[model samples]
Target: MSYAPQKRHSNRAKRWIITIGVFIVVQIIFIAIDGTFLEPSINDSDNVLAKTVRGVLESKLLTERIAPYSFPFFNLFLIVHVVAILIQALGDSISAIFAKR
Candidate 1:
Protein backbone atom coordinates (compact mmCIF):
# COMPACT_ATOMS: atom_id res chain seq x y z
CA MET A 1 0.00 0.00 0.00
CA SER A 2 3.03 2.33 0.36
CA TYR A 3 3.86 4.62 -2.63
CA ALA A 4 7.63 4.55 -1.90
CA PRO A 5 7.99 0.86 -2.74
CA GLN A 6 5.87 1.35 -5.86
CA LYS A 7 8.12 4.18 -7.06
CA ARG A 8 11.24 2.13 -6.42
CA HIS A 9 9.80 -0.78 -8.36
CA SER A 10 8.97 1.51 -11.29
CA ASN A 11 12.50 2.84 -11.38
CA ARG A 12 13.94 -0.64 -11.28
CA ALA A 13 11.70 -1.64 -14.16
CA LYS A 14 12.89 1.30 -16.23
CA ARG A 15 16.53 0.41 -15.58
CA TRP A 16 15.89 -3.15 -16.65
CA ILE A 17 14.13 -1.98 -19.80
CA ILE A 18 17.11 0.15 -20.74
CA THR A 19 19.54 -2.68 -20.07
CA ILE A 20 17.60 -5.15 -22.20
CA GLY A 21 17.25 -2.59 -24.97
CA VAL A 22 21.01 -2.12 -25.03
CA PHE A 23 21.56 -5.88 -25.09
CA ILE A 24 19.22 -6.40 -28.05
CA VAL A 25 20.79 -3.53 -29.95
CA VAL A 26 24.26 -4.95 -29.43
CA GLN A 27 23.10 -8.38 -30.54
CA ILE A 28 21.63 -6.95 -33.72
CA ILE A 29 24.88 -5.15 -34.49
CA PHE A 30 26.90 -8.32 -33.96
CA ILE A 31 24.53 -10.32 -36.14
CA ALA A 32 24.89 -7.75 -38.90
CA ILE A 33 28.66 -7.89 -38.63
CA ASP A 34 28.66 -11.67 -38.81
CA GLY A 35 26.31 -11.72 -41.76
CA THR A 36 28.24 -9.10 -43.70
CA PHE A 37 31.80 -10.11 -42.83
CA LEU A 38 32.21 -13.56 -41.30
CA GLU A 39 29.66 -15.42 -43.39
CA PRO A 40 31.35 -14.72 -46.71
CA SER A 41 34.80 -15.64 -45.51
CA ILE A 42 33.97 -19.34 -45.23
CA ASN A 43 36.16 -21.43 -47.60
CA ASP A 44 35.41 -24.03 -50.29
CA SER A 45 35.63 -26.95 -47.88
CA ASP A 46 33.05 -25.29 -45.72
CA ASN A 47 30.89 -24.77 -48.77
CA VAL A 48 31.14 -28.43 -49.64
CA LEU A 49 30.30 -29.48 -46.12
CA ALA A 50 27.29 -27.21 -46.05
CA LYS A 51 26.12 -28.61 -49.37
CA THR A 52 26.53 -32.17 -48.16
CA VAL A 53 24.53 -31.42 -45.06
CA ARG A 54 21.81 -29.84 -47.12
CA GLY A 55 21.71 -32.90 -49.33
CA VAL A 56 21.39 -35.15 -46.32
CA LEU A 57 18.54 -33.04 -45.00
CA GLU A 58 16.74 -33.07 -48.32
CA SER A 59 17.14 -36.81 -48.54
CA LYS A 60 15.78 -37.32 -45.02
CA LEU A 61 18.99 -39.00 -43.90
CA LEU A 62 19.45 -36.99 -40.73
CA THR A 63 17.55 -39.54 -38.63
CA GLU A 64 19.76 -42.34 -39.87
CA ARG A 65 22.88 -40.32 -39.31
CA ILE A 66 21.73 -39.54 -35.81
CA ALA A 67 21.37 -43.22 -34.97
CA PRO A 68 24.71 -44.14 -36.42
CA TYR A 69 26.40 -41.21 -34.64
CA SER A 70 28.38 -40.60 -37.78
CA PHE A 71 27.96 -36.89 -37.88
CA PRO A 72 30.43 -35.23 -40.18
CA PHE A 73 32.95 -33.04 -38.38
CA PHE A 74 31.84 -30.08 -40.43
CA ASN A 75 28.23 -30.80 -39.55
CA LEU A 76 29.14 -30.82 -35.88
CA PHE A 77 30.86 -27.47 -36.33
CA LEU A 78 27.76 -26.10 -38.04
CA ILE A 79 25.58 -27.45 -35.22
CA VAL A 80 27.77 -25.71 -32.68
CA HIS A 81 27.50 -22.48 -34.61
CA VAL A 82 23.72 -22.74 -34.77
CA VAL A 83 23.46 -23.68 -31.08
CA ALA A 84 25.49 -20.61 -30.15
CA ILE A 85 23.11 -18.40 -32.09
CA LEU A 86 20.11 -20.07 -30.47
CA ILE A 87 21.61 -19.56 -27.03
CA GLN A 88 22.18 -15.89 -27.72
CA ALA A 89 18.64 -15.45 -28.93
CA LEU A 90 17.20 -17.34 -25.95
CA GLY A 91 19.22 -15.28 -23.50
CA ASP A 92 18.09 -12.05 -25.10
CA SER A 93 14.46 -13.16 -25.05
CA ILE A 94 14.62 -14.16 -21.40
CA SER A 95 16.24 -10.86 -20.47
CA ALA A 96 13.56 -8.95 -22.35
CA ILE A 97 10.80 -10.85 -20.55
CA PHE A 98 12.32 -10.24 -17.14
CA ALA A 99 12.82 -6.58 -18.00
CA LYS A 100 9.15 -6.31 -18.92
CA ARG A 101 8.23 -7.63 -15.49
Candidate 2:
Protein backbone atom coordinates (compact mmCIF):
# COMPACT_ATOMS: atom_id res chain seq x y z
CA MET A 1 0.00 0.00 0.00
CA SER A 2 3.04 2.25 0.28
CA TYR A 3 3.98 4.76 -2.45
CA ALA A 4 7.66 3.99 -2.04
CA PRO A 5 8.02 2.43 -5.48
CA GLN A 6 6.51 5.45 -7.17
CA LYS A 7 8.73 7.75 -5.17
CA ARG A 8 11.79 5.69 -6.10
CA HIS A 9 10.89 5.94 -9.78
CA SER A 10 10.53 9.69 -9.51
CA ASN A 11 13.88 9.91 -7.81
CA ARG A 12 15.46 7.88 -10.55
CA ALA A 13 13.99 10.20 -13.18
CA LYS A 14 15.31 13.24 -11.32
CA ARG A 15 18.74 11.72 -11.10
CA TRP A 16 18.74 11.09 -14.84
CA ILE A 17 17.73 14.70 -15.49
CA ILE A 18 20.46 16.06 -13.24
CA THR A 19 23.06 13.79 -14.80
CA ILE A 20 22.06 14.82 -18.31
CA GLY A 21 22.18 18.49 -17.34
CA VAL A 22 25.67 18.06 -15.97
CA PHE A 23 26.76 16.28 -19.11
CA ILE A 24 25.48 19.13 -21.27
CA VAL A 25 27.20 21.74 -19.12
CA VAL A 26 30.47 19.85 -19.36
CA GLN A 27 30.16 19.65 -23.13
CA ILE A 28 29.54 23.39 -23.34
CA ILE A 29 32.63 24.06 -21.26
CA PHE A 30 34.63 21.73 -23.48
CA ILE A 31 33.39 23.48 -26.60
CA ALA A 32 34.27 26.88 -25.14
CA ILE A 33 37.75 25.80 -24.18
CA ASP A 34 38.38 24.17 -27.55
CA GLY A 35 37.12 27.17 -29.46
CA THR A 36 38.65 29.93 -27.35
CA PHE A 37 42.08 28.38 -26.92
CA LEU A 38 42.73 24.96 -28.35
CA GLU A 39 41.42 25.26 -31.91
CA PRO A 40 43.03 28.62 -32.67
CA SER A 41 46.48 27.39 -31.64
CA ILE A 42 46.05 24.02 -33.34
CA ASN A 43 44.72 25.61 -36.51
CA ASP A 44 48.20 26.36 -37.70
CA SER A 45 49.80 23.24 -36.33
CA ASP A 46 51.06 20.28 -38.41
CA ASN A 47 49.51 17.63 -36.19
CA VAL A 48 47.72 14.92 -38.15
CA LEU A 49 45.00 14.44 -35.54
CA ALA A 50 44.34 18.18 -35.47
CA LYS A 51 44.09 18.20 -39.24
CA THR A 52 41.62 15.32 -39.17
CA VAL A 53 39.50 17.12 -36.61
CA ARG A 54 39.55 20.28 -38.66
CA GLY A 55 38.44 18.29 -41.70
CA VAL A 56 35.57 16.80 -39.73
CA LEU A 57 34.52 20.26 -38.59
CA GLU A 58 34.60 21.52 -42.12
CA SER A 59 32.38 18.66 -43.24
CA LYS A 60 29.48 19.54 -40.95
CA LEU A 61 26.50 20.70 -42.98
CA LEU A 62 23.64 21.52 -40.63
CA THR A 63 25.65 22.74 -37.68
CA GLU A 64 27.37 25.47 -39.66
CA ARG A 65 24.14 26.67 -41.22
CA ILE A 66 22.24 26.51 -37.96
CA ALA A 67 24.90 28.13 -35.76
CA PRO A 68 27.61 29.99 -37.57
CA TYR A 69 29.44 30.82 -34.35
CA SER A 70 29.37 27.32 -32.97
CA PHE A 71 32.62 25.82 -31.81
CA PRO A 72 34.37 23.04 -33.72
CA PHE A 73 34.22 20.80 -30.69
CA PHE A 74 30.42 21.10 -30.58
CA ASN A 75 30.08 18.73 -33.50
CA LEU A 76 32.50 16.29 -31.97
CA PHE A 77 30.57 16.41 -28.69
CA LEU A 78 27.30 15.72 -30.51
CA ILE A 79 28.80 12.74 -32.32
CA VAL A 80 30.15 11.36 -29.06
CA HIS A 81 26.83 11.90 -27.29
CA VAL A 82 24.93 10.11 -30.06
CA VAL A 83 27.36 7.19 -30.00
CA ALA A 84 27.03 6.97 -26.24
CA ILE A 85 23.25 6.82 -26.54
CA LEU A 86 23.46 4.09 -29.18
CA ILE A 87 25.84 2.05 -27.07
CA GLN A 88 23.65 2.47 -24.01
CA ALA A 89 20.60 1.35 -25.98
CA LEU A 90 22.45 -1.67 -27.31
CA GLY A 91 23.57 -2.63 -23.84
CA ASP A 92 20.04 -2.23 -22.53
CA SER A 93 18.66 -4.38 -25.32
CA ILE A 94 21.20 -7.10 -24.68
CA SER A 95 20.44 -7.04 -21.01
CA ALA A 96 16.73 -7.29 -21.75
CA ILE A 97 17.25 -10.26 -24.06
CA PHE A 98 19.29 -12.02 -21.43
CA ALA A 99 16.77 -11.15 -18.76
CA LYS A 100 14.03 -12.86 -20.76
CA ARG A 101 15.86 -16.16 -20.37
Compared with the true structure, what per-residue lDDT tens digits does model 2 show for residues 3-101?
Answer: 775775586568557757877787776657654656543364789987887777767552665343466556566667767766766765675566522
Runs in model 2 deviating more than 4 A are 1-21, 27-43, 62-69
What is the RMSD of candidate 1? 11.1
Q: Which 10 consecutive positions of candidate 1 have the poorest summed lDDT? A: 66-75
lDDT of each candidate versus the true structure: 0.53, 0.63
For model 1, residues 30-51, the per-residue Cα lDDT tens digits are: 5455434344343335587877
Clashing pairs in 1: none
- Per TM-score, the best of the predicted structures is 2
